[model samples]
Target: MTPEIAAEADLVLTATRAHRADVVSLQPKALKYTFALADFAHLVDGIDEVPPAQTGFFGPADDSFIGRLVDHIGKRRTAIHPIAEDDADIVDPYRRPPEVFAQMAVHIDAVTPPVVRALTLE
Candidate 1:
């Protein structure tokens, strides 16, 4: 992605850690907001529901839930650890065998619930 695109983004979610790094390299300023999908899901687990005002989403409400959510997740970055390295990133299943693709699906399944729950928390 271009630096401009990254700069304009509220959050960047990639399939893998390497992809997240690639985006970060293009926009170092986005490091705090960029994350692998699985990694972000893991971070979301540490967040406790807070009022909009607490997360800067109150009053006139100029901020989005995602923007505030990202801030909360970013704070938990050091607090959560994946049970395994695989938990932090889903394998790129492009041009792979059915078995490999299934593995990727499993990894996605593992993170999907928490991620979805967090997104719908509003």
Candidate 2:
């Protein structure tokens, strides 16, 4: 993606290790808002004060858990760094064994509930 286009993005979600560098390089300024998918999951997992799941009714979409997660993660970015370059990555399961695929699915599953709650607050 071009730097101009990257700059226009509100947030950037990259799915794997390979795409992370390319996306980060495209918009240096976007680093704070950009996250590898699993990395984001990990980041939010550590935040204890995230609002509890809500139901029934929600206000504007921007005021939801996703928005709050983004804000919290951005604030914590300076203090949090991936222990290894691959720390934020979800390994690619294609062409791999069933066990490998299952492991990847587990990783995704672990992060799904909070993400879904955050996105679907009401």
Candidate 3:
């Protein structure tokens, strides 16, 4: 996505636009997740609807599967890295990337629904 498009997407997800007033009060994390879930919706969006046919059928139930997925997806996806890691007491979202900033957007699209549901039930 172009920088303008990415910024626009962020605004929409964050409910900054007047047209999305119905969803404006959504939590920030939920908004982020919604963005991520939307990004990956084309791939494994239906996974949540059905339980796995077999737990370990795909691979061993360990870190490998997750690691592989992140590695594979993370490359094409834009990553948001910390601006600085040496300061233990600071929490700032001031980082930029040497590559494109697609990962954060992808992550936002991928993880939203469950996070929203979990918060709603709480």
Candidate 4:
């Protein structure tokens, strides 16, 4: 990933720990915002939900809600960091069989809800 892209990102998500490492290597500054998809879900298990917020009355709703969520995860990183680093990895199905791809899908599906809760309004 380009440094510029990483710089502009509000968050960086990867499917696996290795991919997350690559992103962090390229843009160390994003260490706070970068996360493996499942890893982030796992790490945030302890963080309380952040209710969706409305923007200023005069302005349009924007990405600030998401930014606030990302910030909370960053703030709690150390306390919950290592809990799932190894177990949270989603298997890569890049060149595997149909069954393997399906397995990967299941894995993703299982982990998606928590990530959604962590990042989305609904």
Candidate 5:
């Protein structure tokens, strides 16, 4: 995405690690908002109070749930980085066997709740 588009976004969630370089490269200012999907999942997992999945949509509020979550994650960012870097990518399951797909699904499943929770937090 272009820097303008990235700037407009409240958050940028990449599907995989492969996509992160492109997202972060041209848009240095977006670094705080952009996150690899799995990396974000990992970051949100340890937080004690991730807003529940019913706060509201991303915008139109005084402060969005995602904005709050991002702020919280930013505060704990240094601690979150080292542990997440190595395994922050979800495995690509394209053109793979059912077993491989299942493994990929499992990883996605593990991360989904935290992401949902963060987005939904009030």
Candidate 6:
């Protein structure tokens, strides 16, 4: 079920050339990643607890450990400033606003999925 779920999700994500490129670039060495289903499930439960750092929409919470995780994973900080209302670079036709991608990365880094911490290609 997990594989199926993940596969379906990936299929939806990699359907287009541009999206495929973005996904591939976000995390190139993603095959080595192996996320624990149990941990992911637990993460899902507390997922909403993690806040956004920028737009008040899933931004990082003050004094949270996610920042440390991002550092541990060696995730370079990239500012999302100048994000326009209809910014193509930040918009995902496959899902909600593209800003959510950054938000998810925070969660993935903090949780450090045993299978794949940095699935993003770039």
**By TM-score, who's the top model here?**
1
Which window of 10 residues has the lowest lDDT sum in candidate 2? 53-62
Rank by lDDT, highest first. 1, 4, 5, 2, 6, 3
Residue-level lDDT tens digits of model 6 in 17-100:
354344445554322222232222222332223333333355643233443333222221132222222221222345677677
Per-model lDDT = 0.79, 0.67, 0.33, 0.75, 0.73, 0.34
Q: What is the lDDT, from 0 to 100, of the residue 69 in candidate 5?
A: 73
TM-score of each: 0.82, 0.62, 0.21, 0.76, 0.74, 0.21
Cα lDDT tens digits for candidate 4, 62-103 = 347666677666656766646455566787788889998998
TM-score of 1: 0.82
Query: Each candidate's root-mean-square deviation in Å?
Result: 3.6, 7.0, 16.0, 5.4, 5.9, 16.5
RMSD of 4: 5.4
Give a tens-digit lDDT track for model 3, residues 7-117: 333223321122223343333322322222333322232333322223356654323333333233333345433222221111122476733246554444445664344
Off by over 4 Å in 1: 46-62
Assess the local accuracy of residue 25 in candidate 3 as a C-alpha lDDT between 0 and 100.
39
List ranges where model 2 is wrong by over 4 Å: 1-5, 46-69, 79-87
The parts of candidate 4 lying over 4 Å away from their true place are 46-48, 51-63, 81-86
Q: List the residue pairs that clash in candidate 4.
A: none
Q: For this target, which candidate reaches the highest lDDT against the unseen true structure? A: 1
Tens digits of per-residue lDDT, candidate 5, 1-122, equal 78789878878988676677788787877787788888887788856674433344764432566666776676677875444554667777899888978987888898899888767655
Worst 10 residues of 4 by lDDT: 53-62
Error of 6 at 53 (Å): 43
Model 1 global lDDT (CA atoms, 0 to 1):
0.79
Poorest lDDT segment (10 consecutive residues) of candidate 5:
53-62
lDDT of 2 at 109: 82
